[model samples]
Target: MRISPAYLKSGILVSTAGVFGSAFLWLLSFKAMAFWMGPEGVGLFSQLRQMAQAATVGATFGGTNSVVQGLAERKDEATRRQFRATAARLVCLSGFAVVLVIAAAAPLLTQFFLASSAPALVATVRWIALAVLLNVGGTYALAVLNGYRSYPYLALAQIAGPAALVMLLGGAGWWHLPPDPQLLSGAFVLCFGVTCLVGAFGVSRLPKLERALRLGALPKAQSRAFVRFAFSNLVAALSTTVALLLVRSWVIEAKGLAFAGLFDAGWTLTFNYTTLFLTACSAIYLPRLTAAVRPEDRRACMLKTAYLVLGAGILVCHAMVLLKEPLIHLLYSSQFQASGEVLMVLVIAVIFRGVSWVYGTLILATRNSRILVVSDVALNLMLLASTRYALDSFGSLQALSWAFVLPNFLYLVFVVEYACLQNRLMCRRDIWPFLLAGTSPLFYLALSGPQWANSGLVTGLSMVVGLGAAGAALLAYKKVVS
Candidate 1:
């Protein structure tokens, strides 16, 4: 079940294009929305969107990951088809339940979730319910694609849906359509629904879908196993959602809407950038790891990915730090300059996050979900407590910014220990390469002054130095590994 280099390369390209392109388009749309509707409007939009995303995680109920794992374990086409069908059925039912909850909570969400100043923001919360339903549909289709290893089509759908929404929203904004949160959210719902419809069509082409959809097709025993697997993931997903909501709600309550907007924008930038690389890496690596025959091969692959992603994270962090002032000024209005420092702190979190993610994916592939669930719960609780204290003690937004780093660092340490205990992986040796490669970027950032300088010149130099150092380290690592 090893993936060919050609398939891996194509997957990398498609996944990167999908992640980065969608991120770019969505950021542009948000920028446009900010310009037309103001920071508070964007803040309201962001809050509701986050809530919808968090809710959608519950609706998905871990069915997405279960599908991939189930497909990998199944040898017979009939079994695989049955797994898909059962999973899809559960997804639909769970999504309906979520929709009902959203509808029931809409009034409270409108009044309390939104900032009091923006009374008109209630409509956007309602629209998010529709968007959540569409999102669940899209996730189910994506799960099917992942099960089939249809990476290219999955990536295209990911890019297309968001791209369409951004374009539509930007065009409407340009035409001076009355810019409101509800209007913007409605546009999102429309785009998501269309995307889901398109994806459903693509998924229908797989013969397994028809096979799986037959009534009473799978054995009762297998059906129960599928439910068990999905249920574990559902619990993990729900816990993760609660963790995110706790952090986000704290930011809104403690700081203010304006600070939340800044934090959201900065966090989005850092997360999206890291996701661009990680998504591609995960897409190619996860299935391979799951199907890996030898412990040596699995450890080797995981170590390589960890080093590469860690280096990339460092390079991105340094670049963001170096160009923070100018990039913030250019991409967003002056108000967002406050996001510069926040982005810098977030960049640090991203570095640790990259390491944690690589090992975390390995754990999942190994079917060690219990350990992961425990680790994640602990990390999230620590994050919540620390962030609350930081927010209370420090008057600035750095409280939330700083809170993320410690838990991620702790997770990285735990992951290294777990891998060593489980696989006899040489964490001490493997980690040094990543640490050495990561330092060059930090050094570059430290040496680079924080003064507002010529935006173009500084940014160009930062790009050159950061990329050059990262590229050299990667080449050196390849030579050593080879």
Candidate 2:
């Protein structure tokens, strides 16, 4: 069951393209919405969308992992098909049940969150809730597709959904449609639906992949096992969501939606691109990691994946810090320029995040569900606790960056220690050099302007520093592959 390097490479290419391309479209949509809706609108959109994502996590629980586990183990077409069908039904049903819970609590949620009635915003929240089923359902299916190793099919759905979304949003804009939260959410819902539909088609056809759907039940024991695993996933999802809502509430209360928008934007810039790599890495590695029996194999798998992620991450963050302002203006707007500074500070967290994800995956590979849940919950709390303190103490937007950086570093320590103790793994990180290289650009660019009006000495030093980081990252990547 060892994954071939070629297999991993192919998945990496397709998955990277799909995720990155979709991310680009989403970024475009965010920019357009910012222009049409303003910071308040974008903030509302961000909140509602987060709610949808959080709810999806809860509803599906760890059903996705179960699906992946079931499908990955089942080489028999009939058996895998039946498992897929059964899991699909369970996920949709669970998603619907969760949506009902959200619907009932919607009023309370909006009131508590917004701190005002805000009818239109509440309506938007309700509208976005409808997307939960589609979102979770698609995720379940995608994981199944992923388990089947059908990268092309997964890529198709992944790309088409965003492609369709960009088109939908483009049409809406071309019509000079008055942008409201609902209209914008409708576009998002469309993306979810497209992904679900395409994934359904893709999953239904996988065999080497052409197995027809098996709407019939899987074995009773299998069904029970799926439920049990999914329960752990559900707890993990709920805990993370609670922490997110807590931090988000603090941000909105402390600085208004505008600052929240800046926070979200900066975060997206710093984190999202690496997520593309993480997604590809997980798809290629998870199955192989699960199949690995020896602790040596697991450690090698963990370190190799972590190294790859760190190398990719350092380069990406460095480029982001170097080009923050223009990219912000280009991707978003000048109103979002505050995001550039926030982006610089937050780039530091990418190191911890990338390395931590690798460590966390080791826990996941073992199916040590309790430890995984505990680590996730701990990370979420650490983030919320620190961000709350930062927001409360430092009245400036810059505080949010520290909020991200500090909590992530602490979480990295927790995960690293936990992974080592649990799996006898080592956390060999190469960070300081990358960090030095990544921040060099910001030092020269200055708070006054990114304009080249800075001292000549500082500018040369910054370029040298930035180039050195990029070079180190590239060398690290080469070292890993070699």
Candidate 3:
């Protein structure tokens, strides 16, 4: 059941490159786009992007992720090839239909969001529809590459798409081209198209592409299996998407777009950092977890993976929290300084998310999509209720920030409990490490006092003490885990 060192290393490299490359481009794009378009413009763009992603979740029917999981589980070449062909045909047709619906609905959707705002808002929403359409095709290709475990090609496409878009936009800006929503949307379409083409080339490298491309290559049985696997997952993906949109809309309506903008910025930064690490581990471990023969062995591997990922996540979150003030000051303007507290809350939620992925991926690898679907529904419900209550009571962005933390923590608890009960996770070792790591933040916060004594040196000294405490706690954690 042990993973090959070479494969593990390769997976790490590919995942790291892909995650970091995408993150870099996105961070740069946001900075550049915000500089040109202003905070509200970036906020509008963010809202549009989230809407498109939500639409894509509906349009793709959630088959992409399910396809990868199913294909990873398959051993027979014929079955895999048949599944691929069926998936390809279904995804393409569904994507096209979804695009048509989105286009048709764009006017009404834009009108609703604009709500007596500028005409430019309506135009931006229309362009976002086009971006969403192109994204659907690109996402399918990326899913295919993931299914085949073509990590290098997937990584390459991930890098190329964002890098190209950023370069193009930066060039345009440098040449004094006015930054308009249309230009931004066009950049997205172009990048996505290029990525899709590159992903097609990658898929062609698989052994059975020619056979898969042939009409009627997939038999009825495989098609049935694919549908069975993909349908439930689609529902789960769609529900999650709805939950996100609901939260965003609620924030905008109740609080305001400016507050939502701050939340978005903080959430984006926190999620990218934590997800990059967790995703790297999942990419490497999921296939091995799937290929495991014995329940006990699989349980052991899952526990080890969880420990490693959670440990890493704790370290990263601790560092960020400790340096939150200084980091916020350095990266953002005074308008966004309040985001530091939001960032702290988000970091905690993200740590739980990182840990939950290990258990979630194990469920996925085992074709237990039912568990994922159920968990997602329950968690989303909790998130919606909590978010609503928080906003109603606190009426601050921090309320939204705090709302994210508890649901994720509860979800992680549920996932771990289920895994243990199902005999797919063993070893109580994770509990002690989690408790110790979780308390490190309290120690850091305790030493910060009420104020910095109104001196730059004192502020610097306070930060040093907080970070040092966190470092000591982390080292202690490593020792205990080892």
Candidate 4:
């Protein structure tokens, strides 16, 4: 089977648009939360979200990637059905277990995380647990859709969840809902449930999925493979989650809740928007990488993906650094204006993250779970350690962005070396794009510094030249990939 560039382009556009919609909707919801709840309120909500994410990752039993890889590689319907059956049973059982654990520990969780064990807070935590349950199922459905390369349906399900949240948030105004943590957590549960239902409906509409759902028992061998993958994936996912949580908690403890809120505003912008580039290519790239048997073919897929991601990421990150002040005002509030500095440095980290995503996808696609697990854990650990050091040395939350930059840059080096040594994926031609893309953000940083930031003529000229450079690179990359 041939990989058409047009097909790749269409899939990327649709998937990116869907993710953009979700990001935009969340931005709207966040703007309301910022207005009503203020910076400290946003901080508390961010903590709750981190907790939900951790629970959701655990609930899935690390089966998300396994399901995607399994279905993508399996050719026979019967085999795919068996594997899907195994994944379903594993995720369902694990999701239930996670809910139980969270419910049982809610009071303790509230005391620890929120620094109080109030009954109302426990209830709020329990609501988040429910969201985790729903989100787990939703994530599983998404993995299946991704495995089958169902881009359009996958896009729809992605948008529906966030759209539901926006609608619920809007309804809250009409319903006179309290802007407490409970209401926010409940909205999370409702939106996740909606996403799950939409995704399941899409799964049902698949030609083979209905029969697959009905016919197979959970095979022991497949279950073990899924479990193994789950463990590895869980470690990586939990590491990243817990690392961020710890960092946020540390910031809250050190600088206070209001400061953490500002940091989170910048983090939200950096993480959400940068992920749009990854989401754009992931749906199509993973399945294609899994299906390609020859090393040459895999290498080609990796190069094309890296170029597309880097090309787009460089441009977007550049614009973000340039317009971060206004963008922050637009997405958040004037109160969050201080986060502009954070956003400026964070975009460099975002660029590094984009580079890592490209290579990381290849690592995951090849099912080199140990490498993935180790690199992820190490990177997160570096992030935590470096963050503490940076905070102490610089004594500013804006300096937090530096913690991620070096670790991600190191991770980029680690993965590129692995790709070359273990799989021979990189060539001489691939070197320049990575170098150019990686350094592009630095140029933006330089231009945005105190020395040149005030010069409108310089900034305007830089924007023109930067965008032109991006377009030329895209054209050149198109020629190479084609």
Instruction: Give the Cα lDDT of each candidate.
Output: 0.71, 0.71, 0.68, 0.77
Candidate 1 yields a Cα-based lDDT of 0.71
Backbone clashes, each candidate: 0, 5, 0, 0
lDDT of 4 by residue, 1-482 (tens): 24477976787777778777777877777776776677887788788888888888777755367778888888767677788877888789989999999999999887677666677878999999889999999999998887766678888988898888878777775566666778888889988998899999889877564433566664677677767777888888789888887888778767776888898898888875566546656677778887877888877777777666666766776677668778888878899988877776777777768767877877777777798799999999999999999888886755787777789888878877777875765664565555564456455654366667545666566566557656765665676642
Task: Output candidate 3 Cα RMSD.
Answer: 3.9
Ranking by TM-score: 4, 1, 2, 3
In model 2, what are the clashing residue pairs, if there are any? 61-234, 62-233, 206-209, 206-210, 207-210
Per-residue lDDT for 48 in model 2?
Answer: 68
Worst 10 residues of 4 by lDDT: 209-218
Q: Judged by lDDT, which candidate is best? A: 4
Top-TM-score candidate index: 4
Query: On a 0 to 100 scale, what is the lDDT of residue 309 in model 3?
Result: 63
* Candidate 3 weakest lDDT stretch, 10 residues: 446-455
Pairs of residues at least 3 apart in sequence or in different chains that clash in candidate 3: none
Q: Can you write out model 3's per-residue Cα lDDT over 319-370, one digit (the tens) per residue?
A: 6766676765454445666676677668767877877778777677766768
The true-structure Cα RMSD of candidate 4 reads 2.8
Which residue pairs of candidate 4 clash? none
lDDT of 4: 0.77
